[model samples]
Target: MAAPVITVSNKSLLHDQWQLLQPWFSYFDADGNPAVRYQLWDSGATATSGYFWTPTNAHWPANTTIDVAASDISNVWLRSGSAGGSETLWIRGFDGTDWSGWATFTFTTIPNSLPVATVEDQSLHVNQWARVSTLLSYSDANGDAATKYQFWDSGTAATSAHFWTPTNSHWAPNTTIEVSAADLANVWIQGGSTTGSETLWVRAFDGFNWGAWDTFTVASTNAKPVVAVADHSLHVNQWTRVGSWMNVSDANSDTITKYQFWDGGTAATSAYFWTPTNSHWAANTTIEVSASDIGNVWIQGGAATGTETLWVRAFDGTEWGDWDTFALTTTINTAPVATINDQSLHVNQWVKPGSWLSATDPEGDTITQYQFWDGNAAANSAYYWSSSNAHWASGIAIDVSAADLGNFWLHAGAAEGSDTMYVRAYDGTAWGNWDSFALTSTNTAPVATISNQTLNAAQWAQLVNWTAASDADGDAITKYQFWDGNAGANSAYFWTPTNSHWAAGIAIDVAAADLTSLWVQGGTAGGSDTMYLRAFDGTEWGAWHSFVVTTAV
Candidate 1:
């Protein structure tokens, strides 16, 4: 009989050494024999002691003889050796009367299987932490667990700047770490600041070879930045800066890009507001993507002064943060100033003062009133002219208003003596310092007389013995003057003394020589010639003194 056709099917499997494997084998006998057996060997064409397939026992027996029937030929089984290498099996089929040729089969056995990794995608906002191992997992075909792992950025191995810890600490790309180390080190991850998708390449090792790199996507979202502003104080006409009282920060280390401000109170009318470059902003405004756009702010003079609550917000190339408050206190207000100088006036004199009694207000306010007192008693109500009830005993204050200061008069009760007049000016808000002036009341005028004299037509009368002058108030009679007919210099010339008259020219000084030289000349046809005389008491002239001159024609 011809040898039965031998066919051995080889199976490739990842198994541990000394594990069992089942392979199918078949043969066709040409003589149509009912009994056919198969024999298997370990090497090429050399019948060494290996195994024989047995269908009833469902196992392979170690025998060099072909003791298995053709019915059990399909039940071929093999044993993986104790070591891994190129594995070969030699097999032959025999009929009841003829032996078949040996058939050879070749295959390889691996000692350890590679571990494969599967990574899961993750999604989170910026600044949130991500665990490394939580996104990575692996399995081995040889039933081996993952022993170590290495991760990289989206690109190939050794790529940097892909992962980081909460504190921003990072490991280099493709960094190898044992699975136990990953657990002990608490490795976390942080994506880039840009809001988008990120990729991480991961590979695992089962104490053998590393598997293929797998990737996990990290979807990042925008995060808002935090801002803080401190309280600020400024004068009504002063200003504060932006960075001086403001603090800007971010959680994801993002740059500050935008800012908005609010004005909580009335703006200064004259110089409303300004930016860093002194550019005026008629109203509150905002800036975007520019640094220090609002470097400083101005609070002009005469602005409303009070505690105000201002608002500000920030952006980190993302959404805006909550509105923060800036406590602003515009509390500086300078009081108005009033000015007055000392003055001098005579008794019984009503006169309007000059610029000496003027006032000024620092804030340009109006000066409302002035207070007058006696003897520098500025603070004493009893000595000052406050109302209708309190006034100077012999003085008066008039036209006390923003327009003018009319006059100040010293009336009847004022005696001839040295006195003081204190004055203070007032703006609408506050009173100015007191000012004082010296007042001098002069002595009364002197008296002049000429005794009655008789004269004939075309005749002269010696008046030296009749002329006299006196002064009251202990003043000396210093000068004397005479005029005819009480008509002053306009009267017809009826008196002669070297053709020099006292009233029309310089005064005649009181002296023995001057008095004896005085004479009265009669008119041509005069019943009684009236003459006037006056005297000076160094300060004032006394009232005119009249004397009658009797004339006969």
Candidate 2:
């Protein structure tokens, strides 16, 4: 008889499902009356002399082909769930009196279903400790609850560092376990490798196999706080409020515990700290410091100003940050004084009067301008004018006209008189008191006379004499002129003395024909020719003097 042949559809079988096997054999005998039987055995089954057949009868016709279906060999052995191994199936055909050599086939059983696992994402503060646990619900259709788990970081490249496979014995699914602070610290350190967002990976096993990697994300920790102040400047006595003038912010949403300040002197400490009523300092808090608080910062003399530096910093409960700095300046100023040299001046005369100004500030300020006034009014009054006025003269020696001194002349009309002139100095910020001086007008025109203007036409060559001119104000006469008649009435006949003058005393030689021509023009033909003489005292003209000259042709 030929050995029975066994065949399988697949070389390997999954642990979760069953597999089919077929066995057939052919045998021939002369009588064709022998009974044939077949038996099957697995490698794990014990070896025995007795044959184990699928059916109780365990027989088939011989001398012909006989086939055994999968159902006929329903008791064929197979492995499932972690029971897999290199299994061998042995089949043999036997006649009632003869035996056939064994026929064998080999196959393997392998795990097919994968376990289920999930990792939940987390958000926590730095160095925070927690307990993590969840019912893994991990299972393999053919496997038991002996699932294993491990933690992994998404940044790790080699599996060696992440492959910390621990069984569910002490770390069983659904059992809570403490995540040490050190573990959280390590997670934080790893998270630093990828700021803001980091991912953790995990996987589970059903004793014999691992599931797909599952991932969860962790958020990075908070950042430090910052502070700043707006720039500022002020004068010596100025005051300012600090509230709502500074900006404070934190990334972790942490409140500021306190603020510290330094005045370019000692370092800041708790003793010098300012705590807000709200316990937490917010952005734009009002911080005020009075002028008295900065009185010592004011400077005097020398450079005229002083500077101070203020430094500030904030705390966010956890840490103190870097300092922000600001600068301040204090200034000073003083008034000025003025003086005039010439106390008196003459009308219609050009006089260069002396004047000077001086100023000194505790802050060393300089003088800016000098103002002059002609009345008793204040320096800045509208009645007192500025240096820019057309009539104003500015210099060490000022040449001012009496007409510009004041309106006194406009109302007094050149009557010999005296008045006060004022002047003041300025230091840009403050004006000095008005300093005053005297001004006078005294000169008047001189009077003149003709000695003898009566003369015969033939004796016209004789000299005509006039009295020397004199001035009321003691001024010397400058020149003299004469006219045929009163100069005020006959403007056309005015003339200056020529040929005979101061040599013989103020006089002139008049010829007969010139005398006859003067008489004809003056409408004094037969009677007499009247002549007039006048004198000047530089600034004024004197009244004319009259004389008579008889003309007989």
Taking all chains together, each candidate's TM-score versus the true structure is 0.29, 0.25
When superposed on Cα atoms, how far off is each prediction in RMSD? 42.8, 37.9
Q: How does each model score on lDDT?
A: 0.57, 0.44
Clashing pairs in 2: 242-287, 243-286, 243-287, 244-285, 244-286, 343-438, 451-465, 454-548, 454-549
CA shift at 193, candidate 2, in angstroms? 54
**For residue 114, what is the lDDT in candidate 1?**
69
Off by over 4 Å in 2: 1-334, 351-365, 376-415, 447-532, 536-553
Q: Write the per-residue lDDT of candidate 2 for residues 443-547, one digit (tens) a residue.
A: 566888756544343343422233455676676666655555433232112222443212212234333224322221322234565666677666667777876
lDDT for residue 3 in candidate 1, whole number 0-100: 61
Candidate 1 local lDDT, 332-431, one digit each (tens): 4344444444434333434444345555656554566776655533322122222344355435543355454444433311434555766666654457
